[model samples]
Target chain A: MENFTFYNPTKIEFGTNKEQLIGQHLAQFGVKKVLLCYGSERIKQDGLFTTITSQLNEHGIEFIEFGGIVSNPVLSKVREAIKLIKATPVEAILSVGGGSVLDSAKAIAAGAKHEGDVWDLFIGKAQIKSALPIFAMMTLAATGSEMNTTAVVTNQETKEKLFIADESLFPKVSIVNPELMQSVPKDYLVYSAADIIAHSIEGYFTATDQPHLQSRIVEAIINTVIETTEVLLSDSTNYNARAEFAWASTLALNGLTTAGTAGFNFPNHMIEHSLSALFNVPHGAGLSIIIPAWMKWHHSHNTDQFKRFAKQVFAVKTAEEGIVALENWFNKIGTPTRLSQLNITQKDLPLITDNVLNNAKIFGIYHIYTKEVVNTILQDAL
Target chain B: MENFTFYNPTKIEFGTNKEQLIGQHLAQFGVKKVLLCYGSERIKQDGLFTTITSQLNEHGIEFIEFGGIVSNPVLSKVREAIKLIKATPVEAILSVGGGSVLDSAKAIAAGAKHEGDVWDLFIGKAQIKSALPIFAMMTLAATGSEMNTTAVVTNQETKEKLFIADESLFPKVSIVNPELMQSVPKDYLVYSAADIIAHSIEGYFTATDQPHLQSRIVEAIINTVIETTEVLLSDSTNYNARAEFAWASTLALNGLTTAGTAGFNFPNHMIEHSLSALFNVPHGAGLSIIIPAWMKWHHSHNTDQFKRFAKQVFAVKTAEEGIVALENWFNKIGTPTRLSQLNITQKDLPLITDNVLNNAKIFGIYHIYTKEVVNTILQDAL
Candidate 1:
């Protein structure tokens, strides 16, 4: 284990119907007004939007409505929300949808506090010194965004999916009502499982010094994601499975899994961002395509951890068997195992490699995933 | 899984040399003057006290010193500290020792803000609504009071050991430097191992609905504690093992393990408190003596979980074998396996049972560990 500092101040209100108390929580935190951010009309269709606004109204809280956030959330949406927040004075950002909404809300929160463009923070031109407090009522369980200090957003013009991580962006309070997630489409649920697993394993195999306890925590998250996803697929309304999956997803990347892990890298996410940016594929789908390929290419670097993953997660003896078992499980869960399944042709390899190299540079992982190395990984995916 | 709210707001500054920055952390939190609490002169002999006071002096922070907190800390010490704090205008209680010091500091912190007697809060006569902010630099890893909201204290006069758990008791910041724990005596280390294991497994067996993920986490903690304790016992200065053991101890009881387990119980701790209160035994030693015996008594109620614990933690097949294996491990690690090892004879059973019944009534666990049931468990310990 390596020297590290672990401090996550996000307060998660996880349970059934917990979303109904979001307004009360915000009020208790003295958030007088908030910019309510959401992705699609599904929350409205489910009457969740009405409940939230009514609760706020009953609490004597004021809010400005900002919707239309989309998956692979873009800088354009973040800019729009930032402009809205600038025009008005809101004390906080209340994200009422999924990861995309929370990501946009975080970007807007930081942008509203900074004098420069929000993209400046993502591109490392400026630092996020302070931001409006963020609160959330999550309707999805994929990104672990509710309790973390990072957000991913696509810069459409530049064709880049960039992220900003700063201590100031962590949500002050997040309400995770797994019951609200029962209506997630089967395909989305499958993709969410992949996303959670990706989070759990990314650091497990790459850290220079992985603590025994941290590895066990990562395995716990992986096991929970696999088990709960299977149950949720067979019966979507299984509340226990959904609750377990939801909490496990939050813990997967809330900084607990990688606390003492020095030299840990997120190369899979570094490569998959290119897939999402260039092809507009769902984040989890992009990961499913890249993970097994990356794992195979990188397994030799950390053979012992790979073997441990095999034994603990897949009950297999060899690293090769573990990678195959994971790939098979992804296929069983309806996630794409190959880039070709998403209809990308062999000719698209160079474009994907170029995008990934740019991300590698941004993430400071270019030393490991050089242009040629990324090309080989993409070829493996094909 | 059950509907639950998971929110732990304590900030942990974990890693090497973290203790050296305690003053800066307190300053950042706007603490001007603190009631510094600790145990015997070990910190003074080790120069840690001089280092802390110098850091505070450099930071221009003021403090009032309180020391001599012992293991299984008593209410009289807390009351003495509370009287000193009331006379002074300290902003927080800065604990500089292990769990005993932290527990005593927490009692003082809560009592300073309450108008009534502090024991009233522990006895269900009052609630803790506010407290002076608490901070800590932990020198020991057992009894995770650093990042939790609960503190146990024995009433020397009544011989009634009790605890008070409230959100206000959670420390504002806790610095855990495993190097500080490297000098722990081998016996104390073994007892600490038993304590960590007890915290991990208590909820695992008693949760009404054990989520697969939570169970895996419990097993992970148990595995890490067992592995790390063996290494530390041999080498004594192996930093990695010390760090892993320290961290696992914190996570074992920081509200994460029982997050979704609605009806989880802590019968082992409930029973062990009495042993400590009546016999003046070390907290972890009492736990080691009572754990296997309690498991044997309670295994029939949660047989599958016990079997799973056996298979995962010890690679055994049956619950009975698992219990025996754990008891053997305890004895191997130098913890007391039988009550008689502590010079406690069969004649002491009635006195111990009476003390445990008082604790059961206080903890509201009488439904599970009734007087007769606790008597049976204590008798089995003999």
Candidate 2:
């Protein structure tokens, strides 16, 4: 255990039909008018858009819309939204989709207040001193973006996927109605589970000192994700399973799991960002491929935690068994378990290595992840 | 699982040396002058008071001091502090001690703003819409008043030990330095452990619908409290044990363990409050005496969860074994597990029962706990 601070102030409104109250929640935050952000036409096709707009109107709140955000949300979309936000008189950002849309909204919220490019904040050239209040209605559970201060956005032109974390970026209010997630396709659901597991394990295996209590919490999230994911796959409309999985995913990355742990970095996320940035792979698909490979290479550094993870989470005896079981589970859930499975061959290794090295540099993990080390990890993935 | 909105906005600064930065934290919250509150002369004797006052002065903050709060804090102390705060120019209430001090600070923070008696809020005659921002530097790990929106105060006049929970009562910031708690006596430490466990199990057994993930979280808190309590009892100066215990105690009552659970009532706390208010027993001592007895009487209503507690926590085969194992553990940790151990006898049962029935009415659990029912549980404790 080490010195740490734990402070998350996001208010989560969860349960059936909670999303419809998003506008009223924002109104409570003094958000009279707002910039509404989302991805795709799915929400509109499903009538969620009308419900949200009617609620906002009922609350006497006005809004400007910025649609078409994409998975692995791009810098260009955030830039466009920032432009609209700056031109309009919106008081806050209301995100009405999954992680990508929420990430974009956070970026716009911060960038709208800054004078420079939003990418500057991502690349560390500038700091986020303040951000407009952010309100969210999450239709998906992965990434834990709704309740955290993390936002991952890709600069398409630069071919870089990076994240920014500032306490100011935490949503003022996040409405999580798992019923809105019932329409998600099967592949995304499995990928979301993988994403959640990835969140839990990154610090579990890498922390310099993992306390017994923190380990129990990480195991709790992992067990819930594993149990609920399987149940929801068999019956998509299992509302209780969806609710559990949704809440577990939020807790996985919401600053609670890593409290009092020391010297942990998201090495897996650092490498997978390149796979998403360069090949445009889905974030969780990239994670499923990278995690087992990273585990194979990094298990010796923290063998005891690895063995514990095996015994507690997988009921296995050794670290190797745990890695194999996790990889098998990913494959069983229809996610890509290898680079080749994602259609990336050995030929793409150098570019991915370079991209990962850049991320390692940005994240201050370059000492442990030199080009040779990254190459070897990618070779294991291949 | 049920429809729920979970929103806690307390900012916790946890770790070594966190208490020394309390003034700066309050300054960030725009507090210029604070009403510093604490219990006993222990903090002054231990030099913690000087450190806090120097830090506050360094931050150019002014403070007025109000000391001498006691365990199972009473309404008269709160009223005195509220009068001091109202007469002074304090911008916030800063508590520096254990749960009793923080609870008194919360009560004063609410009372300083209202014209009527603060007891009105506890009795539900008036609603708490706002309060002065509250801050804390905790020297103990029990009751979780540091990061929650609940304050339990004994109205000595009415002979009622009751609690008030409003979102506004949450401290704007709390500093938790486990090192500060190293001076706590062994009895208080064990009592704190019992308090933490009591908070975790209240919702675990009584919720109408308990989701699997919520169950896992409750178990995690219980396991952590149990594990750390044993270690700390033998080695009070162990920093890691103290840190884990402190963090786990905070999570136990800060709305994380009970999220998504429905129709739960704090029957154990309701009954224990009467024991404490009537006899002036320590809060956790009352809980330790009441819990096993309540379990013996109420196990049949939620038999599966009781069995789960046996298997998961005590590694036992039945609810009876579980209750005995817990009572044994409580005794091993040096807490009183029976009313006789605390020197209260059968002659005291009627008054305790009457006090508890009043609490049952206050907590809206009268249907579940009539005077006859309360008598039976107390008889079991004998």
Candidate 3:
């Protein structure tokens, strides 16, 4: 166990038809006027547009719409949202789609109030002092944007994919109606499961001497994801299974399991950002390819945690077996575990390595992974 | 596996020397004037008083002391604290001790604002809509007052032990420095462990259709408690073990595991209150004596949950063995299983049954536990 401070104020509502309460919850914070943000109008087709509009109308919550926040949530699109928010003066945000929509909305919600460029906050040059209270009708379970205070945005101009972490950006409330997820396509369901597993495995093997209770909490979530992801991948319409995966995915990166550990390296995420930025690969697929490769390369440094992971999650008799079991599970789910399958090459290795080394800096690992080692991990994945 | 809502906003700075940040965290909430609440003067003797005072003075925080609170905190004492608070007009409360001290502080914090009596709120006669912010430096982690929205207060006038649950009573911040538990007496440690287990048993067997994730969560806590309690019972100064128990107890009934569970009857608590109100036994001792007896009476109704409980927590392959194993564990900790061993008589069973029936109502068997059933359970315990 290690000394740590843990707190998360995000209120999560889980169940069917929970989306109907969104307008009422937002009204508690006195958020009346709103910017309804989304990606590619998928929410409109899924009936979220009508459900949310009817909810807002029933509650007399006024709002304007902003569509076309792209897959990677580029800086320009967020600027456009900031401009719309300034011009319209919407007091808060109502994001009604998946990760990209919420990510873009969170960035815009924070960036709208700041005087200077929003990218400054992403680069850590400025603090996000405050933001419009963001609300989510979470239609996707992948990015875990609802519970965590982290949001990743890409600067298409500089090709610098950046993440911002601040308490100010936490959504006032998140309405996670698992029924809303029944509309998500099969490819996305698979990708989302991979994303959730990556989140847990990184935290699991890297957490340093966690308190027994915290370690057990991580184990519980890992067991849940392992159990539920299979059910979800088998039938996307299995609402109970979808709900479990949704809840587990949210709990995975929501700061509860990271209570007393020092593993802050999101290398899987950092590397994935390169793939997502370079080629529009979904975030989960990028991580799925990189995770096992990173594990094989870095397993020596965290053998004990890996052994615990093996015992608790994969139920393998040994640590090595656990790693193999997890790899097989990912393979079984139609997610690519090798970089070649995702079309990366040696030419892009230096850029991906630079991107990871420039960002991923977890503190408690026995070895400091420099740029060369990052290249090796990426090359191994390839 | 069931519809639920989960949100806990208490900021916890955990482990050794984390108390140093108490001033800074308090400053965030804009508290300069403080009501320093505690039970005994153990902290004053152990140098924690000096540490807290110096830190407050260094940060220029004004303060008042209220050490009159006793264990299973009384209503009149709480009234006294409220009276003092009205005269002093402190900004917030900073409780430094175990759950009893913190629960008393919570009562005072809530009662300070209301025009009516505090006892009225405890007995469900009043709706307490709000409260002042309360914070605690949790030394003992038994009742989980450090991280929950419940406060159990004993009304000495009525000889009635009761509780009040409101969102307003949740601690603004909780500093859990496990190092502080080194000075906790062994008897207190053992009794507190008993209480933590009771929290889980009530929570786990409460609902038949409880989310499968919840069973795993409760099991994690039970498993951790079993391991850490054994270590701490032998060596009270085991900081890591103490810390593990501390976190487990907090999570046991803090709204997470019980979110979607139905019919969580605290028959053990209701039964324990009868003994506590009559004989002045330690609350946890009262609970330990009452729980297994109640289990024996009720296990046949929720046989599957009981069987699962036996398998997970007691590690008994059979349901009967699991019940026996739990009794053995309780006896191993030096607590009695029978009511007669605790000096209660059959003549008292009816009155205790009356107390339990008239007071709180939670039933795992989904049938309202009438006075006759309550008497039968108490009679069986004897």
Task: Assess every candidate by TM-score.
Answer: 0.99, 0.98, 0.95
Once superposed on the true structure, which residue ranges of model 3 sit more than 4 Å away at CA?
A: A345-351, A360-367, B360-367
lDDT head-to-head 2 vs 3, winner: 2
Candidate 1: list runs displaced more than 4 Å.
none
* Clashing residue pairs found in predicted model 3: B265-B362
Model 3 C-alpha lDDT per residue in residues B1-382, reported as the tens digit of each score: 5677888888777888988888887788888999999988888989999999888888888999988678887888999988988888988899999888999888988888777888888866788887888988988889988989888888777888888878898898899998898787777877888899899888677676676777888888888888998898788778788888888888887887887666566778877876787677789888778787788887787788888888877767766677788888988977677878778888878777767765645323224577768777788788
Give the alpha-carbon lDDT of every model: 0.91, 0.91, 0.81
Model 2: native contacts recovered, as a fraction: 0.88
The TM-score, computed over Cα atoms with residue i paired to residue i, of candidate 2 is 0.98
CA RMSD of all predictions: 1.1, 1.3, 2.4
**What lDDT does model 3 reach?**
0.81
DockQ of model 2 vs. true complex: 0.83
Q: TM-score rank, highest first?
A: 1, 2, 3
The iRMS of model 1 comes to 1.2
Instruction: Count clashing residue pairs in model 2.
Output: 0
